[model samples]
Target: MTDTKQEADFLIHPENTFLYIWQLFMVALVLFSAISLPLYAVFAKDIPVLLIIIVFLFFCDIFINLRVAVKTKNGFCWETAEILKSYRKGFFIPDMIAALPWWLPVALLFKNEEPGIITRFLFLLPLIKILKIGHYLQVFEKSLTINPTIIRLIKFIVLVGIIAHWLASGWVLIGPVKEGLPADDFSKYIRALYWCITTIATVGYGDISPDLSQNHQIIYTMFSMILGVGIYGYVIGNVASLLANIDVAKANFMRRMEEINSFIKNKKIPLEIAQKILDYYNYLWETQQGGNDSQVMNELPQSLSIEVSMYLNKTIIQKVPFFTKMNEVFIREIIMQLEPLIFLPQDYIVRRGEFGDCMFFLSAGSVDVKGSNGELYATLGEGAFFGEMSLIRGEKRNAYIMAREYCDVYRLTKESFDELRRKYPDFDQQVIETVAERDAMNKKKTEKPAAPVKKQ
Candidate 1:
């Protein structure tokens, strides 16, 4: 049952599924209108009615197509689908009709890009729909995802195809080769396709000729020249656009990396770990050069190496209050192994009755101390420390420390404290003295009764 639920969830990603259906429907409607309009024009006796239907269908098809294109541009496919679905029940038919052409949809069935015949033939509705929608959505998503190189590549391809087609047709109309061919022959189709290729490539060979009049030849020659120039200008424009996008994305990425690196450096994340993260980021960036978010995400490591490093040596140690008075070298050594930990607001950093194994030094943040008496104890801030008494007495934590805000603290584990004590027993004495002084201060405060009672 759990597996079935998971499968259902996976199959119906609301974002792409609806949009995919909508796009299919729009395409189907356009083709249907194209055929229906012509049929009505030739066979129907009510010319006025046929003309009106054709005009209405044309306008409807254009509106839907434009809506789809605009929604696609904004990356709002799911929203578009929902909006369209709300209109009428019959709206779904077009999408179904569009999906009937099985080749492209079938090609998307298998996990591999190369589709097999058996897999192609088998119409596993849910799985096939999922795969088809996922793949095309990815391509559409790439229009927003890829940085610059890919955008330039696509523009260049389109510009070339358009100009090539225009120039090829023009050249065939002007040259002598046009004398032998009918207006709508296989030869004309070949000429148009060939022109699409050659003009885009800027390759002008004088092999084909048309036997049209001199005036027509001149007009055709001029058109071909204009197309070639236009293609060149379009390519140049796209190149500039690509460069600008690359610069912006690169600048943004660099800024973010620098900020993260500064954080790690200040918090003293090990150089090795920091380097690993940087390396991984670079690897992901390279792999996702012309890819989308999913591509980049897939290439990223499951978790950062630094996170794993933190979990490895998880021994807890309490801070001795007296350690605050230690020399710079001694303090620095302790701080070196100490990692800064962060806690979210209202989160319990240290719970009452839990075995205390680590000490915390408040670096920059506030924590609420709750005592067993159900009274609110003091809130601690920077330079303040906690969990020391429990660690020294070898007892469970007596109070709960909860973050009043996002809190940052330096933590030292029991193993590290023990190692420090073994190296310098004199330092241990300083800690004991510091604890004694604090205890004496606490006792004095408790003993001293309200002197202001006389005024009242």
Candidate 2:
């Protein structure tokens, strides 16, 4: 079992770089044991160096499991006694015996004589490590940022590859080992692999058909064919599911677009207006990925939501001269109530003569300060605040505030701002000081004479 204990309590963090590296090393050792053990047991000759490593890792794994944090039914078991108890109750014995290099001992014991089927089964004992792969995958799933669906798909492929490798190894020891085998182990393994793939994928080709005369060989071939059919069906279903869910955001976006189109068609809306709506939706999909940011924040606990909202609007607050001098508590209280609004290109957030109950703070993209005849006075980018003077004084807007591009603007309602300001006496003085200068600047800009027309 992979332990994902609390970070403070962990002996080794699952996300630690060293832990992942160690896991990769262990997986490599398992693969080596899985392949070499069965193949070497047939000859029972010289001992390989990997057998030494496996024996060493077998002991190391015991200590690693005992110390590493383990999660349990209640939660992560941080107590040392409980950790040991969990390990003892889990795969400790089977993993211990399976991880042992039993084939090494058998090879040495029967050095002069070749081993039989019963003795060869000692090499296969290590196959249980293959089962513990599920445990290792849990660690990877936590540490790696890759999509789980992608991981599962890759895992399935690797699993099939390992199964084929195992079957190929066994195929070599099926009958008279020398009858139709290649000159070398590599070539022999390759031939066995080819037969396994062809046999399992489809009924084997005539060129590599199994001998019908041997009862065991026929039975083995039949099982492989049956297993192949099951594998084929399972892979197709799972792979299809994975591919469909790979782009969930896109899927949701399309569904929303379809519903919008249906409404547009039913209402007999003009093509130009419909196109603009579609463009607005496209911008929403790109920026928010077909989801409501407010709803997402609302789903989080109030404490977390407050921190996240404040963090996102932190820069905007710092940029506001009125807010910069205010205490963090006042800033945070106001920021939490700010609602996000997106404006598409050329869309007027507030027209030159429209009354508004809210002000906007630009968080991303840019907007234009325009007047009659679409005269652009200024292009405000991120951290720019506008529409406040109108809200504070309860007067009509002096100039058009239009989005120059897709803009993410956070709106603070007059009611919310008033509520927060009421609790702080200094807030009124700061607002009065800032809006006076802003009012003078706007009056000058809006009063400017019209541009000269070129004489033709």
Candidate 3:
């Protein structure tokens, strides 16, 4: 039953699932509809079924946009007045305009005659519908989970296609290829496309050269050459940068480890100690993504890192009684002061009677608390914290704590605690209240009668 409930919960991620479905649907709709427009124009008589399917898909796209606006916040406004306001000045206004072309054809249905000049021009609505690609690009950029490099690459590809289509349209409209060709409109566009690709790639094949005798054709050709150089350079630079980003951190870490290994050998360090060092390095590399946490944090702006840290540590820190009532800023400060730690199985984290200077927040795994005689007192798991009593009161640890398994924890030292208390008077009061409660609990435990031991 528990497994079933867990599975149900896993299936209940609402926003992310909706966004994923939305992205896929939009990509398919745009690609299919966009490609269909040119083909429909070329072979209008041959593929009546394809034209109907394209028309149906266009209407589906309009409804899809309406649904998106209704379901997604800041999509299209839900209120009538707000929807009008958004139509005037919102990100979705272009999408609304793109749908207008579909309605024009519908309006012509009332005339019941050969299409008018307006209706014929309305066939060009597919050009306006291309705006949806830009809308999707904006959406993809805002997504946190998607890689920015991939998003940039997608944008580049789409831009190149759009540019190529525009150039081909210009070429066909200017009559550079001549009207008497036996080939159809599709064949003409294909020839224009071939010229555009060669020009943009700077691979002037000379077989399909543009008609440079005409001034417009010469200007167009020159523009294509310049644009091609810029696009080619942009793609090369971005791909190189992305590859460098992928390799730099990993390569640097490997090189540093090699140097460390060579030093260990030169110093004749004990094999057991060297192995432990290597294990520690490996654990850090795996967990920290091959960089020092402090150094990484240092690179980010203080406010940005604080927000990120607060997001990660807020839930765990809230389990600490003293932090329960603290404000976000206070909690963020505490998170910034915390240091990460990892403990191996059976490792003694805190020994009984030792002066404790820090408290631990167990982020993962389990630990056992034992009394002075090594009898188990209690076991604590993830989100559980301990050592606060000693850290708060400047006293010796009352019990020994050891990791029952490999554990990850965050430690907050007394110095940071003291600084916080000094900065925030409210923190001092919370600390005092927590200390009193701990003292009272300890007194009750000391007063209780000892349990009788069972005979073996």
- Cα RMSD of all models vs. native, in order, equals 20.2, 6.3, 9.7
Per TM-score, the best of the predicted structures is 2
Question: Which lDDT value does model 1 have at 241?
Answer: 71
Model 1, 354-373: lDDT tens digits are 98788887766798899887
Model 3 whole-model lDDT (C-alpha atoms)? 0.72
Computed on alpha carbons, the lDDT of every model, listed in order, comes to 0.55, 0.79, 0.72
Each model's TM-score?
Answer: 0.33, 0.85, 0.57
**Candidate 2 ranges beyond 4 A from true positions:** 1-10, 13-17, 31-44, 71-78, 112-120, 175-181, 432-456
Residue 34 of model 1: what lDDT?
38
Give the TM-score ranking, best first: 2, 3, 1
Indicate whether candidate 1 or candidate 3 has the larger lDDT: 3
- Residue pairs clashing, model 3: none
- In terms of lDDT, which candidate is strongest? 2
* Model with the higher TM-score, candidate 2 or 3: 2
**Per-residue lDDT of model 3, residues 1-106, tens digit only:** 2536524433212235665666667667667666555444433433245445545565665544433322346332334344344435643544554545453444
Clash count for candidate 1 is: 22
Count of clashes in candidate 3: 0
